[model samples]
Target chain A: MIRIKVRPFFQLKEILKEKELTIELTPDSTVLDAIEELTKRLSPSFKDAVIDKNSGKVRSYYRVLLGGRDLHQLDDLNTKLCDGDIISFFPPVAGGNRAT
Target chain B: MSGWAGRILLVDLSSGKIEVEVLSPDLKLKYLGGRGINSRLLYEGIKAGIDPLGPENLLIFGTGPLSGTLAPASRFTVTAKSPLTGILGDANCGGGFSAELKWAGYDHIVFKGAASKPVYLWIFDDQVEIRDASHLWGKTVPETEIMLKQELGDSEIQFAAIGPAGENQVGLACIIGSNYRGAARTGMGAVMGAKKLKAIAVRGTKGVKVEKPKEFFLLIEELCEKIRNSPIYPRLSVYGTPGLTTLLNERGYCSVRNLQQSGGFEEIDKIDHEALMPFFVKSKSCVGCIIHCGHFFEIKEGPYAGEKGGGIEFGAIGPFGTHCGISYAPAIFKMANLCNQYGVDVLGFSTILGFAMEWYQRGIITLDDLDGIPLEWGNYEAAIKIFYKMVKREGFGGLLGEGAVRAAAKIGRGAENYITHSKGLEWGHADIRAFKGYALNQATATRGADHLRGIPGGELLGIPPEEAQKKFGTAEAALPTSYNKARMVLHYQNLCTLADALEICKFNTEIIGQGIGIEEMGRLLETATGVAMSKETLLEVAERIYNVERAFLVREGIRRKDDAVMGKQGQEAVASGPFKGERLDPDKFNQMLDEYYQLRGWDKKTGIPTRKTLEELGLNDIAAELDNL
Candidate 1:
C-alpha cells in the first residue's frame, strides 16, 4: 500500500477547500491511477472541475506534482507512486517574479 | 495621423525648429501603427548608413490605433536605430503616456536633428510647444515625474521623461514613466538624449472612436472574461512576474551569476512572490486594462523600511537576485528601487554589474577600476552603491555606464567572455538552456534579446497531446522540443508583431491561449478600424511589416551570421538543477532555422526575404529599395 498526500496552492486551494488529503493506493500506482481513485470519491462538481467528462482525461493545464517537482518533468501521468509520497495538484496558474 | 491628428511632429533642437507633416495614407495602411509604423517612417525618412547616436538619427514615439481606446494594455512604443546594437530597436512602455499622446491627437511624434540645449515637448490637444528644460535635465525619474506633474498642475496628464543617466546619454539609460513603467531597452533614452529632448508631456480628453462601438465593446468584454478566467491570470494578478523564481529555479532556466551556472539561490524563499505580497499596498492598471498587474509596495520593518515603490517584475528580480548573487528580499527590493529611481533598465544594469564582478574575480578588472569598492557576488550594499554611481556617471561607474558590451570591449583581457548578451542587449531572466525556443527568438528579435517579441505560448499553456501532435506532427514538438522550434518561434514572432502593431498586450494573446487564434484577432481589428480583414490578410500584413524591418536591418549591414548566437554560450550546458547538462543542440537549431526561413519565403542561405517574396507580400517598394542598398 502507498499513502499519497495532496496539497494545493492559490485558487486551487479555494477549489479544494481542504488543505491536505491522504488516500491509500496500490504500490506503483501512477498519478493518473490516484487521480481516478480520488475523483471517484469526490463530488460530481469537483470531479467535473478536475477532469473533462467529454474526454475522460485530466485537465490539460492541471499540474500534478510528485513531491516538490512537476510530474510533467518526470513520467507525467504514468509517474509511479511510492510509500508516503507527497503529491500536489496545482491548477494552471501563472507565476510571479522571483529570483531563481 | 485622421483618426490621428494628421501630423508627425518633428523637433530639431540644434536648428530650434518644430515641423509638422501629414502622414501618407499608404504609410498608415501598410505599417498600421506603433513600432511597425515608426520603423517604416524611419526607414523612409532617415538617410541610410547614418550614425545611430549622431544628430542625423531620429527618435520616434508611436501610438497605435487601439491606443487610448477600450483595448487592454494599449501602450506606446519608442523606436530608433540603436546606438547599442547598431540595428533596428523598439521598446514598448505601459503607463498613461501613450494613451495621453493619442488623446492629444497624434499617432506618432518624430524628433530630428539635435538641440544646442535641453528642451521638453509640451502637447495640449492641438497646441504644441518646446520649452527649455535646463531645470528638469538632472532630476531622477521619480523626482522628474513628480515635478512635471506639479509644474503641469494636472496629475492626470501623462509624462515620459529621462533621468540624469539619460541626460548623460548612457547607452542603457531608459525613458521612465510614472517613476516605474518605462520603454527600457536598446538605449532609446540615449537616442532621446542625442536629440537633446528632455521629456514629452501630454494632456487631452478627446477620446478615440471605434468603427463599430457595439461590436468592439462586446468583443472587449468577452476577451476580458477570458483573460480573467485564464489559469495564468492569478499569478500575474497576485505577483506580476516575480512568481517565476520557483519555476525558473526548478527548471534550471534562471540565469544565475551571469549564466555561469543555473539554479540554487541561497535566499530564494525570501525573494519569492508569496513572501513579497504582504508589502503590496495597491494594484495599478495601464490605460484601459482591467488586469492591473502592476503592484505598489510599501516596505515595513526592515533596513529599507518605509520605502515605497512599485512592484519589480521578473527581469528586474532575476538580474538583481541571481545574476548579482543577492538573495535577500529587502536587498533585492532596494536595488530595484535604486534602478527605478535612476531611470536605467534593471536587466541592463544588473547584467553589466554581473560582468564587472566576474571580471574582477578573474583579475581582469582591478580594485582601481572599482574605486576601492570590492566587487563581490551577493554584496547587496555594494551593488546599490554602484547603481548610484552609475546613474550619476561618476568614477568607476562612468565606464560601467557605457553598458556591458562597450565596457567589456574597453577593458581588454577576455572581459567579453564573461558578458552574456545578444546584440548588445543582455538576456532577461528566462535562461535559454531550459527554453531553447526563447534563446533563438531572442537572437533574431527586432529588439535586442527581448522575450516579449516571441512569447512561448503553447509550451507554457501545456497544449493537449493529440491536438499538439496534430498541429506539430509530433507530441514532443509541442513540448519545448528543439526540433521544429524555429518554425514555432517564427509563428509567434508574426503573431506578436501583429499584436504590437495593434498595440495589445502579449498577455491578451497568451491568456486566450489556443482558444483565440488569428481569426479572432482579425475580427477585433475589423470592428476597431472599420476595415474588413481576414486572418490571412492580417497575417500577410504582419509578414510584410516584418520583412520591411528586416530590409532596414540588412541595409544597416546586419548579416545572417548576426542572427546566430555567440559560440560556447549557445552550446554550453546548464550546470545544475532539474535540467542539468541540458544544452541547445546547434545542428537541430540550424536545421530548424533553415525550415523557418524557407517557410517565410526568405533566402535559405542568407536568411533575407527574397525579392519575389517581398513582391508577393506587397512590399515591392521595399524590395526595390533593398536592391539599391
Candidate 2:
C-alpha cells in the first residue's frame, strides 16, 4: 500500500480543510482512484466542490497536481500514484498582477 | 506632419491663446508619434532641468496614426517632465479620449505656460475653448466625467481629468480617464495641474479617412478573428489580466510584501477571477475595440458595498491584496475606487504603502510616523484612510505622498533598504527571479519597470510545456532564452508607439489578435496613409524612432549602470513554491544584456548606441549630437 498526502487549494480548501485525510492506496492507484476514495469519506458539501453532480465527473478547470506538476502533464487522471507523493487539487481560480 | 494631422494645437493657458502650427514631417517620421513625438517636442520646447511642478514644463497630449481609425485600442499619450523619474516622462492610457482628439482633427495638443486661473480645454471638432473650471478642479475623476458629460450634453464625449491629487500636484498623481482608465504613471497629472488644465473635454463626429478602406477593414477583421481564437483571449476576456495571479502564486512568481516573499495566499480563493466574476456588473471597451477587457465591479458586501468602479487590475490587486497580505476582493475593489477617485496610480500608491508596512514591522517607522494608525500588513481600513490623507497631502501621508523612492530617501535610516524599486518607480507584480526575461524587460523599460514595453514572448507565446521546459530550463528563462526578444521588444515597442501615435489601445494589438507585427503594421500604415512602405523600411523607421528616444535618455544621463535591478533580486532566493531558493543567475542575465546591446549596435559595456549603429539606423543627426556630448 502507498500512503499519499493531498492538499486542497482555492475553493477546495474552503470545503475540505477537515477530513484532511491521508489515505492508503494501492501502489499503482491513479489520482482518480484516490480522489474517488476521498470523496466517499467527505461530507456532501465537500463532494460537491470536486465533482459536478449532474455530470458525475470532475469539473473541467479543476486542477489536480502530482508531485507539484499538473496532472494534465502526467496521464490526466490515469497517472499512477507513488508512496509519499503529494497531490493538490485546486479550483479554476487566478489572481495577482503577475502570473506565477 | 506628412501622415499626421499636419498641425499641432498649442494652448498657452497663461495668455489664453490657442495657436495651430504645422509639425514638420521630418520630426513626425523621426519620432514616430505618441510618446516619441511628445518627447521630441517637449525636449525642444521645455528648458532642461526645470522644476517638474513649475509652469515652465510643458504637458502634451499626443495620438498615433491608427488612433481614430478602425484600428484596435487606439488611445492617447500624456507626456511631461516627470516629478517621479525626473527625466522624460510619458504614460499611455486607453479610452476614447485620443480618438476624440483625432476626430477633432489634431494629431497632438501641446499645453504651454500656466493658466492665470483654473480652466479646462473643450475641443469640439475645430472649435476650441478654454472655459473656467474652478468648480470642476476639486472634483473626483468620476464626478468630473459625469459633470462634463452633463454640461456638454454629449454622453459619448470622453474626458481626461485630474482629481484632488492632481489639484494638489501630488508627485504620483495620474490623469484619470473614462472614470477608471488612466495615464497613471510618471506623475503626468501634476504636469497637467502645473499647466492649470483641470480637464480636457473632447468630442469629434468626423470619421477617420483610410487611404484604402476595404483592405484595412479586411485586415482588421482577419486580425480580430485571430485574437478571438487565441488561447489568451478567453482568459483576458473573462477575467482580465488578474487571471495571472493564481498562475504566478502557483509558480512562486507573485511579489508578496514588496518582493520579500512569494506563494499562493491562504485567502487567494476569495480573490481569484472566479470569485471576482460574480461582482462584475458590465464591461467597458476602448475606442474601436470589440474585446472589452475593462471590468466594472459593484461591491455587494463590505464596508464599501454598493460602490461601483472600473478596474481592480493586476497591479492594484497585487499591492492591495497579496503584497499587503489582504486577499479580500471587496477591500481591493474599494482601494481601487479610492485611488481612482483621488487620481493616483493604484500600483504606485499601494507599493509605497506596502513599503511603509514593511518599514513599520522592522521598527524603521513607528505608529507616530503613521499618525497613530498601526501600519500592519493586511490593514485594509488603515490603507483606505491613508489614501485620503495622500490625496489631501496631510500629516506623514504628505511625505509618503511623494512616492516610495523619495519617501525612502527622506526617512534615511534603514527605510531605503526596504523600499523595493527600480528607477524611482515601484516594481510591478512580476518578481524577476521567477521571470528573468521580464527582469531584463523591466530593467530596460523606458518608463521604469513597465511590463507592456516588451512582454517576453517566449513565455507568453504558447510553447508546448515539455518543449518550453527544455528550451527555457524553467519559466524564468523562457523570456531571456528566446532569440527573438531583441526583435520582439523592438517590434512591440514600435507597434505600441504607433498605437499611442494613432491614439488606439495596445490591447487592440496585444489582446485582440496575433498582434500587428512589423509586416502587418507596415501594411496597415500604407493602407491608412497611402504611403507605400515595405516591412524592412517600416522596421528601419521603428529603429530610427527607438534610437532618437535612446539619445534623449542618454542626454538625460541614463546609462547601463542605471538599468540595474534593485532590492534583493540578485542576492536573495525566492522563498517559496516551485522556485524556492532560486535567484536570477547574474551570468546568464549579463549574457542576455550583452546580446541585446550587441543586436542594437550599442557599446556592450556602456549600453550606449555606437555611432556606427546610430548611423546605420538613419540616426546620423542623433549620432553627431551624441558625439558632441
User: For candidate 2, what is the lDDT?
Assistant: 0.72
TM-score for chain B of all predictions: 0.95, 0.93
Q: What digit string (tens of lDDT, one per residue) describes model 1 on residues B20-94? A: 777667766776788788888788777667888898888888888778887774688888888777888778888
* Each prediction's TM-score versus the true structure: 0.91, 0.86
Candidate 2 chain B least-lDDT 10 residues = B475-484
DockQ of 1: 0.24
The local lDDT score (0 to 100) that residue B595 gets in candidate 2 is 67
Candidate 1, fnat value? 0.23
**Interface CA RMSD, all predictions:** 7.3, 9.2
Clashes of each: 12, 23
